[model samples]
Target: MLHATISGNVVTQSTTATNHSILAFLTSTIGQISPARIRVDNNTVINNSTSGSTRGILVDTPDTSTSPSFDATVTNNSVAIGDSINGVSGLVAQARKASETCTSLSGNTVTFPNGTPSGIQGLRARQADTAVYDLQTSVSCTGTAATVLSCLNPSATTEVLGTINTVSPGTCLLPVTP
Candidate 1:
């Protein structure tokens, strides 16, 4: 995905997921390297599991010599977990160079039925100003109400579900709107 929809100085890449369920999934990655100016909107990923290995979406660019990638957006995607998927990421981006920018990751949701396995993150970004990414709208649903939940004591009389998780805007980098 190398900026296929470029007109003059403007470039864009876009994808959407609507009314779909991904079951018994087996993939190391879903989306990768869609150039600068990309969008992923309104998709559902359900019941997906791997042998402790898999990534949902990767927004990245390898062109280290040019100006930074701009305006990458991921929005409104939902991921429902299966069992014991470790080190999985719902969204991740890499910007190694000083001039690189991350764009945005917004309005995405990840529901871990039994709670996310160890070392897994609902969303993450690396090597760029957190300002370039929008993690605020993303969420995680855990605990008893989740599709598959476990308890420390199976015979416990009452259960408490986990709370929803939201990313705070200022926690990333300098506060800047993308």
Candidate 2:
């Protein structure tokens, strides 16, 4: 799809299998030569499962020779995780090998239940291509959890365009409330 807009929705998932509440992927099949633009905003996502690789929102572009460029914006969404036995994510944007991929995140909130498992990420951005991959975020993003990594596993090609505030231990950057 070239362009899509998804906004103002509430999604709840109760499963033990790997799943994503909101997912968008740009593929190279069917001779998709142009870029893809997707917008996800103002939604509430709830994950009620305690085990699985669950995610609240995910946007991805696969690695292929004829992959199209992608631009996605995710904003003003709320995500709540009941618990996690394995790794889980609130939001993730990944561009494996696209020519150009841009992702922007702003005004999002994520919360995890108390005593949740470790290695839970609130926001994650990854890019693995020689081309440009921009990941931007505003200052209004926030994550609340007891043992969570607010932001995790950002690759070298991912460029974050916002003020980054790091918590203690210096392994993650959580956005400060403004």
How does each model score on TM-score?
Answer: 0.47, 0.69
lDDT of 2 at 81: 72
* lDDT per residue (tens digit) for residues 1-178 in model 2: 4668778999988766467889887777544555777788899998776666677888876547656676677777887777656547677767665456656565677777554457556666565664455554324333422112233222111123222222322221222222
Q: Which candidate is the best by lDDT?
A: 2
Query: What does candidate 1's lDDT look like per residue over 80-125, in tens digits?
Result: 5454545355554445432334334445566566766676656555
In model 2, which range of ten residues has the least summed lDDT?
Answer: 152-161
Residue pairs with colliding backbones in model 1 are: 17-42, 17-43
Q: Candidate 1: where is the Cα deviation over 4 Å?
A: 1-35, 62-68, 83-85, 97-99, 128-178
